[model samples]
Target chain A: MKAIITTTGKDKTGILAEITRYISDANCNVEDISQTIMQGNFVMIMMIDLSRSPLGFAEIKEGLDEIASRSELSIHIQRAEIFEQMHHV
Target chain B: MINSKEILETVRMVDAQNLDVRTITMAVSLIDCISDDGKVCAGKVYDKISRYSANLVKVGNDIATEYGIPIVNKRVSVTPVSIVGASSGAFTEIAKALDRAAIENGIDFIGGYSALVQKGLTDAETRFLKTIPETLAATERVCSSVNVASTKAGTNMDAVKMMGEIVLDTARLTADRDSIGCAKFVVFANAVEDNPFMAGAFCGVGEGECTVNVGVSGPGVVEQAIRNIESGDAADLTAVAETVKRTAFKITRAGMLIANEAAKRLGCKFGIIDLSLAPTPTVGDSVAYVLEAMGLESVGCHGTTAALALLNDAVKKGGVMASNHVGGLSGAFIPVSEDLGMISAVERGALSLDKLEAMTCVCSVGLDMIAVPGDTPASVISAIIADECAIGVVNNKTTAVRVVPAIGKGVGDRVDFGGLLGGAPVMKTNAYSAEKFISRGGRIPAPIHSNKN
Candidate 1:
């Protein structure tokens, strides 16, 4: 069970640190991270293993609400199978 | 790792556009439940439905939560009641039992209060067909259908006439709710057995003992994708199709996952995924909006059918690879009342019934969710059915009629069906009666195209 965690918003310091702390608290191991700046917005994508995570997707969504709202970031986390189903097949 | 753009695109599809699995339909065969005694048979039918669909709604919600997508409806289809209730003439009891099962199991609606009379009517079928108006008026979740025509067997004008009167009776009997009972009945031509959408889903006689089918709906996603990719002069018809095909592939895959999980949880075999761009009353989620994305001025415009043909074919090309088996009406549905764009077009005089009939030849479902004047003659209604049926029969596609003749409502009046069924402005019908032609009561012979066999 792999999932993708993505955030897009204005650039800021401690952005990666804040995201990493949330992942650790949710007990999900982040395997990869990529960041880019496009059209004056900061975009970050993370690959994580939800298989061993203590939190379910709904619970993770609940826990990320404050981080997303306070940081003014549009965040989305869902199973990677949705994307792989389209692109790979 | 998936690309950042792709992840963002999916989020937009889910969060902004109303992408959803329209239905997860369990096709439960009642072959084993039929008996000589009406009471025992009705009991058996109820027991079988409850046994098979006990976990249907639970499993559907679980999958929706896991995938983070909404599964809008969970329903069941059974063997056509004409056959299941033939021995004892227990059609009403059987309908009641199906409704009880749907309520108890949390299924939205149960279909297959239906009869197939393309060639001719059997004694049992006539008896069952007589009970449709009363049964539908009495029950909340039972849908009934009658197949009045087919290419191979030709049109049964007798059945068509009976269906017209029955539809009128249903409307009058349920007139208190804006004649909404008529919305639950469908008259079909070349109707497929594996349809997962209502008011036309029924488990075919040839199907297995039990199967699970899924109907995937996402007109808004396709519309949004078109909006995102559109640029000046660089994009053309072919590019538009590729975009729709790609989006449809993704939607179909998501639906298949739910179908597999739900079928597994309920201990049934997977049947098929209906690849239809079913619309809703919501503004953005209209099939007409998707057509407008292809640069059409209105859905009933001259070039609408060509654009729809492209969209319908593109969706199939994209969805075909994602599912193990694809059945039902696998194309775009242009139900007028359920689509905001179509409703606006009709209300503003940009669309008409004649043009809509032309559009149905290239779409999945035909002449669907349209409301006509209250005094529209039954013979005229039969003529409409005959015309739509001919399109399906000659073209070898599945098409159906679910017109509501709003009792005491005429042109420009809107009838509210209150939910996903939506509301429709009463569109004008052909004033010239086809009664003289319809009065010639016999099957219209199959066209030359159907002579392949």
Candidate 2:
């Protein structure tokens, strides 16, 4: 259950902390993190192993959406394999 | 130590801002490989190209990764394949070999399977030009071009007429895949050599054996740079030009370093640097955004021309200072289907073909990425190409038409060529016949400007 999460949208404070806390509470292990600012917006791409997830994909997506709404951001969660298949071509 | 919050905020800004280099193209001219023996010439041509461009993809990829910038495409443009094929009588084989070389070297597209027959054609030129359809259809990586007229040479009526047939033939041959052949072919009236831009770059006969040209683009970067400028301040033409010039200068310098490095590594002569602000299919990476930044409600409006002219001039002035050899059509491009802002403009009824043509009079490439109805007559398309070419010739600048007449699609219909073709909304054209006018094929005399002693 390895996943890559990409957060993009309006720039605001504590976005990274809130998302990381959510993942930590879910018992997911963070593998790598990278972020960049482009065109006046903030984006973060995090690769995490969710093998010990407290919840599955749907629950994680729902939880992340709630956090994103509160922070005024957009969150996308996809399987690492899916990301690789889509981009590595 | 850098604060984590500060670094995260910076990352967000970089992604949202869409700061990236669109392409890093290597121009390799094959003019010097000319020889009397056809087989010997083909072998030399292949060996020369392989040796020169072997490391191009690797170098471009390393630089892109090093800078963390997305260099989306790595391409090569040669001296017109026609020039290389003229004496050798190896047009088809040479085209195949060139395509193979590019594919093996991992380049995206290889251009200059071309001919410059503005006034008249040589026997070799005619044979090479006629084979473009077959060559383009047979090869995946090869792109082709033809220059039918120039201000000095006037317009070649015979060549223009022949191109009409050629375009129709090429389109028909590749019609199964939405006429992808036309995607690889462009017909020019005032085609310029030393253009780092494609699918119309050819090493003009006037250029050195090999030279480096840079095509720098940062539409999204430039757009973001001016986003916060007040509308009142943005309305100041000089202020807007200065901002654009500064951004263009930085982007051009980056390209210059890469071109010079690639040239040195390849051991070929470095050429001029082209400072074109090429846009991509992605959102925010658009020339129209640059125009919108200048306080224009939309591109193709009345003030668009003035804005574009100033921007083009400022880019040239700034870029000329950054690099000694600045050539190619170094300006903005207003292609209808290519840029998201432009597509939105068309959808909003703010942009039209005529207005686009007028914009090209000052911008870089002319009448680019326009989509017309599937059933549009070949003659009408030729007339359209002729009119645009006439502008290039009259203005003594490079002008080209990369129009896609999507089969089975009509006006207002959208055809998605996907990826870089973006989404082209079919534009309406006048139904009036230009058959009588285009049918009378004769050369248009070179403009008076070519009479230099």
Candidate 3:
């Protein structure tokens, strides 16, 4: 399944490195990645193909949360279908 | 690969320009939760709201953070309480329950504690209308409204009389805070179904089971865009309309994205999008500024009417094209005290109550944020509301009045309700009595349009 992951929180070093490492380790192919700073907050949106992943949503969510907690960030994960269903008019 | 620089630049533009989605509101209809047993009805009402809105704020915040936009308020509007209150005194309980649920769920406000008695009042609507002063005073973050007249329903003279009393009583109840209770109350005529605004907004019974509605606003942005354009460049009506349309399109898109995301995250249905150019007390964020951008020295000038009409129409067209769910009273707001430019105009004697009403024919709300002499009798105020409602009925559009009669104050004085209430300069009104006309309590027949095929 293709998935979209977004991370946002206080700015910090190595946030991109840590999150990208997690995605690559899960055997997911990264489709797109974008990051920005707005109103003093850091935000990142990533599109990835998770069909080759070894875990389901819950497991991936837990693993991301652990990394997020360590990095003092907040993360959200949604299936690509859900994302398009919301944005596509 | 997506260029990180492009994304960063976009974020920088938004942050530096103060561009962000203002509100992501959930519109929940309480029509299905109605029951004859008051206790059962209240219980069901509470359960439905709690179940539907429990994670609303959390999800909104989550999505906002994820998307790098600021969702300032997470609000909910239910089916008008009076509709469900037809068989019970449960309105009061429902009001309390809705307020508690919103507070508990971390939402800023819960709206639609209202009654639509435009043509006439049912027994339950009358009861609900009478309880507003107490309801507003007793609960926090619970907004209430009443529709006393409409084009289709004509003007309800009886209901308008009761509303005058309600507004006065509500002001008196919260008089300690300079009538702060009145701030949470609004009396509307020809009320709309999909408005995401407060004090006058209610989920109209004509809408779907559940829908998302957006209220987009950006006076500051619009002002900035027009700042560099020479006054002569905006002299032509078509140019002014195009400018307003383009500005409205951008603002509506931002608000629509946030609202749709919030609805998705909450797993509830999405609704309409309201494209009102709501203003603030800040500099350059006034509807008056838009008027001035059109070469008018002030809002009450002769050309102001023509200017406002074009601006309102352009905003509606642009917003309608941006979202399929566009509904509500989508137009510009001309609240005297709420907009800094308006307050200045009033202080400078450039804007007047009569002119404000004329502008309301082209905008969303009418006679908003206007303060008249305290000693002004309730009957005269009702007359003012009736006059504005007549226009709504004749024109087939939604219009409302929120006039605050500041007690113990006279003409040419000023009352500051502080934030959001902004600062209002008390204006003079004709010292005429309409008591005889208002005391006659009955329904004003629906307009000629209601009889059509």
Q: Candidate 3 residues B1-453, lDDT tens each? A: 334443333343245444455566778888887887887888887888788888877777665555555566778888999988777768888888888888888878888989888766777787788889999889988999888887766888998888778778877787676666777787887788778887766777887776767676766666555664554434466766776777677667666777777667777677878878777776666788877877788878788888888888988887887778888778888887778889988888988888888898888777788887777777887888888888888888888878777777778988777766686988887677889989997877887777776
| Model 2 C-alpha lDDT per residue in residues A23-87, reported as the tens digit of each score | 99999999889887879788888878888886866677779879878778877665554223211
In the range B1-453, model 1's lDDT, one tens digit per residue, is 477777777777777899989999999999988898999999999999999899999888777766667899999999999999999899999999999999999999999999999998899998889899999999999999989888887788888877778988898899899889988999999999999999999999999999999999999999988987876664888899999999899999888877888888888999999989999999789999999988988878889889999999999988897887989888999898899999998987889999999998999889999999989998988889999988988888888999999999999998999899999999999889788888878788877777775
Residues B333-430 of candidate 2 have per-residue lDDT tens digits of 77777799899989989988888888878887788888888788889888988888788888878788888777777888887767776777888888
Each model's DockQ? 0.53, 0.04, 0.09
The TM-score of candidate 3 is: 0.82
lDDT at residue B393 of model 3 (Cα atoms): 85
**Evaluated with DockQ, which candidate comes out highest?**
1
Supply candidate 1's per-residue lDDT for B46.
96
Error of 3 at B192 (Å): 1.5
Ranking the candidates on DockQ from highest down gives 1, 3, 2
- Backbone-clash count (model 2): 26
Each candidate's TM vs. the true structure? 0.95, 0.79, 0.82
> Candidates sorted by TM-score, descending order?
1, 3, 2
Fnat (0 to 1) per candidate: 0.54, 0.00, 0.00
Query: Which residue pairs does candidate 3 place in steric collision?
Result: A1-A51, B151-B393, B211-B270, B211-B271, B212-B270, B212-B271, B214-B274
Please give the TM-score for the first chain of candidate 1: 0.93
Lowest lDDT 10-residue stretch of candidate 3 chain A: A80-89
